[model samples]
Target: MGTDDGMQLAYYIVLLVVIGGAMLFELSGRGGQAIRQMMLWVVIFAGATLAATWWTDSGARQQVLEGGRIEIPVGRDGHFHLEAELNGVPIRFMVDTGASSIALGRDDARAIGIDLADLAYVGTAMTANGEVKTAPVTIDEIAIGDIVDRNVRAWVIGGEMDGSLLGMSYLRTFARVSFEGDLLVLER
Candidate 1:
């Protein structure tokens, strides 16, 4: 199971333990009024726990502010994926520290208003699949969370890619990029 599923399972287990303990206490001569009050509090606590879990799992918790730094949670796929605005258009990027430069998928480039017809596929990059031709481009702006960079160097891969890559070219701009537990922190 994924982290989300594991977390949910843990939550349920804790809830059951709490309820079972409450029942045992009630059976052990705890007053009916006290038991009822405890059950009410337990219900309230469970509701709050569920709400918090939902909110955290909803993606809002992925963007965390730590002073001037931003932390992105590692996704279920074990990758740090983030939503960024590229040239005024929103795009999703998978963090690839091994990549020398930012690499945009053809479809992502098109979505960001890049004209494929105008691009010259003169550059080539070696990948696990094979060497793929690419077209160099300079993004006008790329923003993630509150961090923004201008005139960022990137490329449009000539072949198909699952998603745009936020490579070292972009990550190196950060003052520090480190992984702490499951979070990737970008400091500027």
Candidate 2:
């Protein structure tokens, strides 16, 4: 192997062994009670650190009609409820600027009582894996927080996907978009 590459691999191996040994030693200390308590404290401290990091990193707060919208905490999956519904139906959509159009999952479309057959499959979207054909449809309404839009163009993503995505098409209507760390703040 090359000298630099070999040295790097050796360093990583040594680091892992040291860390593993330390962890094992720590686990075996004080008849396991002390070790357990220590582990608990470590977990608590880690969680607190993560929470603090998320709070500080998430961008500016959004003041919508009711009150405000805050960033969703890290590791806590699902969309944040800054507001209630999108297009007259309760929806929690992840904000995705990469999407060219606002995309809705099949379930969400059905919940909103939108007829999938009426929409035309007008475009092909390039995804991470490959290309997926998308159908285009117009929603009569979409409501979030206090903001509402009418006659919005949306793409229906087929298959077992659960949630809809709010993309730049609808987001552009907002005055400002800010993200701090994991938090995305949208202002209208």
- What digit string (tens of lDDT, one per residue) describes model 1 on residues 72-179? 888767788888888788897888988999999998999988899999999999887899999999888887767778888889999878788888977887889999
Off by over 4 Å in 1: 1-56, 59-61, 64-66
- Residue pairs with clashing backbones, model 1: none
Worst ten in a row by lDDT for model 1: 59-68
- Off-target runs (Cα >4 Å) in candidate 2 are 1-84
Model 2: per-residue lDDT, tens digit, 10-111?
875676567556766776746677667656666765576578657754653334534433343322443343333655677767767787778888878878
lDDT score of residue 187 within candidate 2:
59
TM-score of 1: 0.68
| Best of the candidates, TM-score | 1
